[model samples]
Target: MDLDHEPATRAHEARLWRDDGWTAKVIKNGDDDGWAVEMTQEGEDEPALVGPWTMGRDKKNPKPLDSAAFITLVKTASEVLRRHEQQRHALLHKNVTIDSGSDRLRIDLDIIPDEYEPYAELSAHNGFGEELARVRVQPGFKLSRESAADWVANNFARPS
Candidate 1:
């Protein structure tokens, strides 16, 4: 997020309209002579989508925002953000189960790709849902039967 990527875009002319967690702002398109609209949601730093804007009757200025059109834009933009979040959630979290001697152990991996610090956590849970171990590993840490077995055998210390 952080539409702040463009400082000038941070503060533009007043928004034409806003509804359903979306704000629509029309701006002159830099690539072409036509205008473009940006739809941003509350708490999100970036706009969900941006595309060409329709022209008004004058055929020179962009068309004014209307209730029906704005509502449609809100739904489309919301869907875009929702799908993005879901995809990231799937990529950041992973789970698996492996047989550790007799009792089965559930393994979970969560990755945090921070700008300054990227890391992943590997955790083990017993059949009864008791946490056996949690260790911080590199972002590229591999989760597999062999790795889980090593962790369980090494008293939870991170594999060398």
Candidate 2:
């Protein structure tokens, strides 16, 4: 593992289930905590997610980055992505709508907690509020962002 390089901008490829995408402009390394990965969609300016990663087995305050840690990070990061997708799918209904003129799509997802009967509704509009989809997820279902991402990537990533 090498910590010599300063925390610069980097990118990493991520694949989860039916979704395959790349995370660009990831911070190389962090100072106080372990390495941090900044993730965002290609066209989206705001970051979709950002998570703190573990350092190598150096037993130091901040472990360096290495091949092994990188692999682990990928696996961990993939799981995060999967969970997000699952949560989105579970929370929302399967209704999708597309607009004609603007070429926009909108998706409505509802997440219900077991404790409460009412579910939280989240509406995500792409391009415009034209393409709309909705899904109803189990309120009791637990959401593990990391595990879900890993499962999808390992089991459902597109070949090659």
Candidate 3:
């Protein structure tokens, strides 16, 4: 870790620190008139995690950023990023397959959750690497083993 970019060690003040591509900053909390800290990964526009800061012994002000506290924050922030990536992976790539007569059909459900509108796609591919059909579906579309078989039986028609 670069010392200049990293949060200063054994210090007492609301400051910013960079370590292993993540940045941690302690700032004043606008909501509660207290201190809050934000942790953001490098190149990301928004902070991955934000939480209330600890108060000093006097209880009137936030505790100065220290090595132990910084370490804890880094661990917590890392977890937040990891969970976010896992969720995105689950949403973007989902697959299932069913045997439709002689050839097996692979069903894929891809979802893109946008702010304005979320959409999903239901696609089918045959065992010989042939695309049978593709259709747009609602984000909340229910998909299961039975559903995939039914869709195939219906000649890959869009499910109602």
Per TM-score, the best of the predicted structures is: 1
Clashing pairs in 3: 7-17
Give the alpha carbon lDDT tens digit for every residue of 1-160 in model 3: 3445644243244577666666778888998868898987766779989999887788877877766777888899889889989988986878898888888889988887877999888999989878889988888887788888887788878888
Tens-place lDDT per residue, model 2, 35-137, is: 5555554344565656664444774433444444455554665677789889777555433433434554443434554464765443335574542333334
Model 1 TM-score is 0.72
Candidate 1 C-alpha lDDT tens digits along 1-160 = 4665432323323346765556788889999889999998866778998989987788889988877778788888889979999999988988788887789999888999999999999999999999988889998888777877778888889865
TM-score of every candidate: 0.72, 0.30, 0.64
lDDT of each: 0.82, 0.44, 0.81
Per-residue error for 53 in candidate 3, Å, reads 1.0
Q: What is the lDDT of residue 7 in candidate 2?
A: 36
lDDT of 3: 0.81
Model 1: per-residue Cα lDDT at residue 128:
99
List runs of model 1 lying over 4 Å from the truth. Answer: 1-15, 43-45, 153-155
lDDT of 2: 0.44
